[model samples]
Target: MKKLILISGTMGAGKSTVSSELKNILPCNVFLDGDWCWDMQPFTVTEETKEMVHDNIAHILNNFIKCSEYENIIFCWVMHEQSIIDEVLSRLDTSGTSVKVFSLIVNEKALTDRLFEDVKKGIRTEDIIKRSIERIPLYQNLDTIKIDASNISAKEAAQLIKDKLK
Candidate 1:
């Protein structure tokens, strides 16, 4: 049977890292990172842009769900709100697929440290780090399994999800 794994988390909580590791560990898996769909030049996070990105993600995921080429479709994104999760779930066709949702969580200290390292690596800026940290609370009370990523490596977190799939 096929499976759809939706992984959500804060910016520095290792969603992308875990997704990559999960893809490596799982067979016939298709990995989709929502950020890839929104490679906008300006990169503004307006309401309209959010809707467009979500629509694009949903459409692509819908196609993945319909395809039989992959046994597992892994999607990672910052689904900070329940409504976004609902919207994505509503867009998918799960006739013969098992769906699993997981959220990676980290404490503020760990998050700040990670984002700080990212900033030092020149991949991210201070403004982005502050903004991401500010939005950490948005993941609260989300309707998904929460995995503590504060001290775990990406491979370890991927193994946890892998164990769950079995």
Candidate 2:
């Protein structure tokens, strides 16, 4: 009876800020930060924590289904592989739950600029940024809407998503 709007994009792609603006216009929604799934301790993305990230997402999805107070959920995170994205979506699609995904993407230049901004904010590093550059969408279905975050303002992008969802 409710919708799950899953938001995915590279870091600094404005997913969080744009989602926030869209949130004011939405009803019965819950916003989740995918990065929060990462170990809160300061650590680089490496072999040690790879599975943990996926596991964390699965756990979060479970929590969302169990919450009795909310009618809709918007889960936001950095999504890289389409297979992985689809797998997550398939899992969440079970048990009468509806899942929709929106992907925010940009070019290498934007990635560099955003990653550098993260370096300043202390959420990323040169290595992490290097690995993510040129990463493509993980899912290719018609249900997914991919937006160019580099060429638009947050307000404009949010409107784009709202329009697309209509």
Candidate 3:
């Protein structure tokens, strides 16, 4: 069975950085970037988009995994809220696929700085810091392990994940 590793965190908390590093560290593991599932959807900040956002998370992720090349998959996204988290877990559980979750977190200031850089680089489609911060406090509670990412390089972060997986 293909093991599904979901590395989730708040925005700018190094999810992509660590995901890439971890992908390199793991032998024969292929990464599926959670962001690619965006499907060119318009970025939105309205509360009205909540259902759409959650549906995107579950639908896009599940669909990608269904046809992806890798049997063992590692994916990263800024996933908050237990309901959304449960969607993945429930599917993994029901399907008998092994699953692991990790949360990467950092100081609020570091997060803000990263978000700013992402915005400046035109990578963070939604550049609203307030919305980003509003969701940070909950990431730690949704995962099996929470890694303090403020002081760690992506390489070190990846090593830690590899160690834990072993």
Candidate that would win on lDDT: 1
Q: For residues 1-69, what per-residue lDDT tens digits would candidate 2 score against the true structure? A: 666777888666778877887676677777877777774677678766766776777777767766766
Q: Give candidate 1's error at residue 57 in angstroms.
A: 0.9
lDDT of 3 at 129: 73
lDDT of 1: 0.90
- Higher-scoring candidate on TM-score, 1 or 3: 1
- Per-residue lDDT for 4-46 in model 3, tens only? 7788888788888888998887866767666665545575656
Candidate 1: RMSD over Cα atoms?
A: 1.3
What is candidate 1's lDDT per residue for 1-166, written digit by digit as tens?
9999999998888999999999999999899999898888988999999889888998998889888799999999888888988988887788899989999988899999999999999998888777788877777789888888889999999999988887
Pairs that collide, model 1: none
Q: Which residues of candidate 1, in runs, are more than 4 Å off? A: none
Displacement of the residue 142 alpha carbon in candidate 1, Å? 0.7
| Clashing residue pairs found in predicted model 3 | none
What would the TM-scores of all predictions be?
A: 0.94, 0.76, 0.77
**Alpha carbon lDDT of each predicted model:** 0.90, 0.72, 0.73
lDDT of 2: 0.72
